[model samples]
Target: MTEIQDRPAAPLATATFESLSPITGDVVGIHPVHTAEEVEAAVARARDAATWWAGLSYDARATHLSTWKGVITRRLAQLADLMHQETGKPHGDAMLEAALAIDHLAWAGGHAEKVLKRRRVPSGLLMANQAASVEYRPLGVVGVIGPWNYPVFTPMGSIGYALAAGNAVVFKPSEYTPGVGEWLARTFQETVGRPVLQVVTGFGDTGAALCRAGVDKVAFTGSTATGKRVMAACAENLVPVIIEAGGKDAVIVDADADLEAAADATLWGACSNAGQTCAGVERVYVHDRVYDQFMSVLTEKARDLHADASPGSQMGPITMPRQMDVIRSHIQDALDRGGRAVVGGLDAVGERFVQPTILVDVPEDSLAVQEETFGPTVTVARVRDMEEAIARTNATRYGLGSTVFSKSRGMEIAERIRSGMTAINGIISFAAIPSLPFGGVGDSGFGRIHGPDGLREFTYAKAIARQRFKPAMALTSFGRTAKADQQLATIMTMLHGRGTTIPKD
Candidate 1:
């Protein structure tokens, strides 16, 4: 068997397996890890659902979505528990993510008609008499390959918007979180009384199957290497794709910043979810003036956080075992290159749980700074000024999200950064606004998954033009005369042949 097939859920037959708790290693639930055949079947069912869904008026779809939102709200605790069990995130964090997703769902459903309705446009002076309009049409079926981190919020960014835009969705959740995927689909089906949104669970192969299952578009979220593979797979069918890949996002602290708040935001951004977030702050550049103060505060904050399998644990296991090795390697690289660990260091990584780690004075080229460790580890560097901090922050190829903690220069530094979203004063708060677009640029991947842009990503632009009246001069037929041609030339000359002074009344 391939190395991927030998992972945690390898023995399942129909892409079905038991989800184990990352902390306790206990089997949480059994789920089906769908194969290509199941994905095709789900898509076939979705295609029929899409036809009916597309025929419905905007109000009708909104009503169904409202009902689904109510169902999710009623079972919020149940779903959050499943999320926490499968992904090993804090219960409050899981609930917060789910609540935000529901908010986006409501936003998408309420605003889709306004954002995508037909609108008139000028046809330019040459065709001023003719009327032209543009509208967005659904692309039929959309496939979403979700990640394990923030499983609900991330995938719903695509699924909720796709459905609001009158498209059916077939989602393949990460193997580690298939139970959450199934829970979402079940709730949706219960509310809508149709498989408008279906779930197919599996590892990467099942995700690959969804890409090739003839869907109109695919929205994938994962590592950069895996995104490339997903893109190549989708390219085989010429299907459009939206990729929300990984990031080594950085946080910048200026001389005018609040050292305590900066330390709090940085620690939360770095160690949250055991540091498995795509937009997690993995690197930090602090002004030299507050470097010592920020480090001292961060060390204290991180010390209070612990990764355990208990109910009230702030941090949990790494979820994926192999990721432990990568996290270790990154910390080791930083240490070997003369970096000092102010908190948990190389010994922080255990068999499952990874302790919160904070490294200082790490070389820029070290793996901790250059690669996505995706663990409870962060690297902090001291810079002379904001310019140096911004320059070093923008040097990485990944620009998914960043945090700026400057009181006076927050906006200035945020605009100069090469990331898609920048959270000033807070870490990753832009994701909650529902108005700002979220996605990365360059190697971090392209296309957005939230707000109006998310609604449009699952659709195609359709333009329509109709002639309002025939022109006064019939130049199409053999009716053109020399006098008419001379008149046209005179008009052209007066309008554009040469620049002229403005006429005085």
Candidate 2:
């Protein structure tokens, strides 16, 4: 039996919080700080809904998800505008994010039946008389705690897959992006004609309540420190969890690489979304042979980029205002520690936006290099070779996404990086592929949130073995004679008498 947390009775709620726009600090929307009791009630409702939803055939569930996909795709612009207002990202970026999420939804719905359906398996020689099979069953209800960055694409990694696997979901969006969460649930309800997906919005306490709300599984995407807390909360109920946490991702530029393309991809990966991306490039290690040329190109391209909440802005304001201080501290620490800023530095961080800041010659131990400076800032370091580049890149506690820009050895170098996803000759493109599983290792969190692994993450595997015929050798019954036991031993010896030896590759 699974152990449950000792949850205290939640008091009635009379409090509320407002989602403010990060750009102008204007109120985007108001929502309640749902109590533990309210969250559990929502879970209870989801549990009931899950039974009916799970009872449907995979094709039936796929149909519903497809319908929801159409609804979201049709209103892509509307949702993107809402996302822009709440998160302060450019409309085009928001649309791209939403479109990618929609694509994932389609993939999850279209492939779930083939991926999760029961299938037969060989029973092996020892159990030749039995027929074996396995199938993945829904875990009933799932709780997702989403991050503010890439609000749509990130959370849907779990949400879309969980629903396609036949579980009802209750999502808790970040305090800064609750409206986006509400809009998603509302649209899903509109298409499905049921509250299969629900939203609970508020601050940290509200999210904590969701953690203790007795859901079967929890999918959390946020900072590493918060991921630890979420893991602890989920431990109370022995519930399974998937955490997509912080990253200090790096980009490697080999001597033989396309220097211009490498610099362009790295800059975009680092500065796009105001550098709020978890998988965004925060570090770059270039081979010493071409370090000078790479830096020259990177600096020139970065100088042309800017962050603003106004129209025509390629980058927008930081979604979370508190992040400004963190970004400023990192830049200041880097500069004070003998690092050189080629483009923007301490002055780049403003009231709401952080301009593209490029730091070069920063110590590997510097906070800007080690920690997740989730603003549009990146630290570039020189390395002697690809070996040193891989070593330096893997030295961080984070093991999320990484990039390699080598014409011949991109995949070879990427394979050596201790990260979950690696982009070859590109930047953060793994998230765009719906078939790829996305997550991280070590401090970056565990379990996956996309593809077949994601569909299975919110489910339990049920295995069955049926006896097809009676075996000639009866090993389980007392009716077995001494001669029968001897014969069985003789047969076992005949099959395993050979000594074990290592095979030469």
Candidate 3:
């Protein structure tokens, strides 16, 4: 085993933890339980590495990132397999997740220079004599707390972008998938020949340590409850944080939607990766005219899907065993509230897997509809029209991602839904697009981690205004006269004294 160098000296107890394969509950790897002091040391080393990284020219950084990207792309299968073993996701789903992450890496590397380089800004009439420009500078070091579900893809959203923006990253992956995180760091080290990216493995205490380790910024992805805790920890140091939290995402079906296509997308969105996705479709609203037909098609499609570790399975076991109880509770609550399970019910949630479950006529206030089940379950509800559909979709405290299926009103309805990203006639397609930003609002958490905004998230804007010529009125100087002040006041009034009005009124 190639141990990560610079690990803090072990204490007397020398505690450790094991990463277990969710599929078989076998030990995948054993790692030390890094303490707060160790996490702080890692960040301190990252601070030094960040200086060297940020000092490199944009082309130099891009070249290095490109090399790392090529290494990951060529060995995509190897990484995907690790993702599968750690998260218990199907191999094909792991591949898709890794591929999307690779694409984002490429985009972040190729566009960092263009996005962060200094550029001139309009000085406006107030500062016309000054030449003003703004550029993004890398924050010294960034701390990343990753989620187990979609381990590789989710963390890379922050890691890749942060590196592209010229910052070193210290990542603390979820305990359930520490092996995957270690593999990433090892590969990155091999490609870059430096500790520009490092991993510290442990549980929640390790994550909280990273937040308080004096990093310039922290990017966290997990549940909303955990996100709040992460934010509170970061608050101790007044460190900035970008939180990608949980969501109760929905899919809205319009009367004019392609019923077949909508049903297919809804089933896949709700059951893919065993529906552990934070932005997965948990609640679906269909127009009353097509509700029955859509439900029939969805139920039939879901019936064909199964969650298991067996070969060629459509889904896999829940990465976290505790989530099984949550899934069962939601199903039971829905049933107790007079809802009927169209496909699978409470029994669908087995020891490690949650089968495809579709509930109908679930009350709007039911936990199945109001909370994130984080399992392969969805509640189908009827709406009188698109108006009600939009209203119901926006009723949740979480606004992460949503989907819409309509022929003419797809974009229109999507616009009305309050979410960070909305896919029309597609399922979670925005995540694969490199130019579009990904994040959420309200309880889903705030801050983006992809696209140009993602690059800037790990950086601070530095603005410079040089005096190109002396102003006619030296308003800012002690030499300014009362006459000049009067003239400036008159100009200000002339520019903004009048408010425009409608002629007809």
Candidate 4:
């Protein structure tokens, strides 16, 4: 999913990469392609800063994070403009992404104390003389390797929560959107007066180096293949990592569902960001009773929308250039496998943009259905019943996000799907809530981000056991007498004798 890749470092002080605008193929900016040495240096600085940052009280940290959030909120349009240039998503979409991320930042800062602060626990009868307590402690420095699609929102799910939990972060943004990463670091530096949030720009080497640079944890967002590599790199140090990778998210429509509402949500979820969303709807399983009506409404609305760089276009160009080939290939394969294009077909995929494409009768084994297209295309299939729909939805190896649209059985069906999160009657609503965790199971990758889970991801649990008084049993002392042993046997027998099983021949 990333455009830039690993290359040998130049002999100069620093090598660099050009960020290209998907709309015009023009160079938007040039950023340094940091080497392994530079990544290590950044981690060293972050490790030092983490000590000072973690020393501050939770309320103090919240205040500072709020200031940075205010800065981002005030300059939302500016960040959105950069996002549109690098990612080529619509201005409004870019704004919305950054806005949601900012809200998460605010929530992380405001709720860290309540979610992470130490608390007391009851001691058991045998250990009544002991007091037990537990709290989450910060893991020094965190490395974040962000994805190009939804660059701001995706990485901030890690960066924001990690900081709120009292850790310094070193972010390695996707080579495609390095400027946005630098902008965030620059602003945080000005507001917080430290390098608590820093940026390292480069390609795959930069990210791989970040993982080996001795950070406490690494949070990554991208393809499932790349996620495995990240896991391997961190294995040497046993560094805990959270991977927010791609998904072939599906939507299930029951016989009792609202066809019009379902169609509108499906189209938006599929084509909104030109289908680069990691959790965008890629497959639909509709009950046979409402299949025709749902398809009729979906295709009609899809026809009215288009992808282009032209002003006021609802959809924007594909951010990564190579992804266009993948998009087109999927469409062609679906058509070759006896799928009917009820809407735009292969002709819909252009050099930089892809119009909405809806396929009917697509085989479940086809690439368009089995893999992550990451394009503005969807496959619709008719199911015999709601049970069949649920089975088909859970068939994919990816289990990230899913949608269930049913008036009476929405919750029931949603819970049945094997995904990290599900939207009962909405599209991607779990991501916006900030309290529900976002992630995947199986091939979609592991670990979670967002909510209390996210705040705790960059931390480790520390437990405390305090002895309040001497135990009457003196179990650990060699001075125990025969009477003590008899008493212990009596206590055990009294507790479990009635439940013991006996066999008499």
Write down the lDDT that model 3 would get.
0.89
For model 3, which pairs clash? none
Count of residue pairs whose backbone atoms collide, per candidate: 4, 0, 0, 0
Off by over 4 Å in 3: 1-14, 500-505
What C-alpha lDDT values do all the predictions have?
0.89, 0.88, 0.89, 0.90
On residues 1-505, what C-alpha lDDT tens digit does candidate 1 reach at each position?
0012225445545545778988788999887667778889999999999999999999999999999999999999999999999988989989999999999999999999999999998786556667999999999999998888888999999999999999999998888888999999999999898879999887777888999999999998888888888899999999999999889999999988998999999988998888999999899999999898888898998899898888888887788878888999999999999999989998888899999999988999989999999998999999999889999999998989999998888898999999999999998999998867999997788999889999999999999988899866656669898887887788778866777754332
TM-score list, all predictions = 0.94, 0.95, 0.96, 0.96
Q: Tell me which of candidates 3 and 4 scores higher on lDDT.
A: 4
Model 2, span 1-505: residue lDDT tens: 0011112223455467777787888998887877778888999999989999999998999999999899999999999988998889999999999999999999999999889999998886667899999999999999999888888999999999999999999999887788899999999999887768999876677778888998999999988887888888889989888988889999999999999999999999998888889999999999999999999999999988888766999998987766788899999999999999999999898888888999987888999999988999999999999999999999999999999999999989999999999999988989999899999999998999899998999899999999999987888899998988998888777666665743232
Best by lDDT: 4
Q: Can you write out model 3's per-residue Cα lDDT over 1-505, one digit (the tens) per residue? A: 0011112334547689777887899988888889999999999999999999999998899899889888888999999888888888989999999999999999999999999999998887777899999999999899998888888999999999999999999999888888889988998999888789999988777888899999999999988777888889999989999999889999999998999999999988889988989889999999999998998888888888888779799899888877777889999999998999989998888888888999988899999988899998999999999999999999999999999999998988988889999999999999999888999999898999999999999999999999999999999889989999999989877766775632230
Q: Give the higher-TM-score candidate: 1 or 3.
A: 3
> What's the distance in Å from true for residue 290, model 1?
1.6
- How many angstroms is residue 102 displaced in model 1 relative to the true structure, after the best TM-score fit? 0.7
What lDDT is reached at residue 180 by model 2?
A: 94
Worst 10 residues of 3 by lDDT: 1-10
Model 4 off-target regions past 4 Å? Answer: 1-14, 478-486, 493-505
Error of 1 at 273 (Å): 0.8
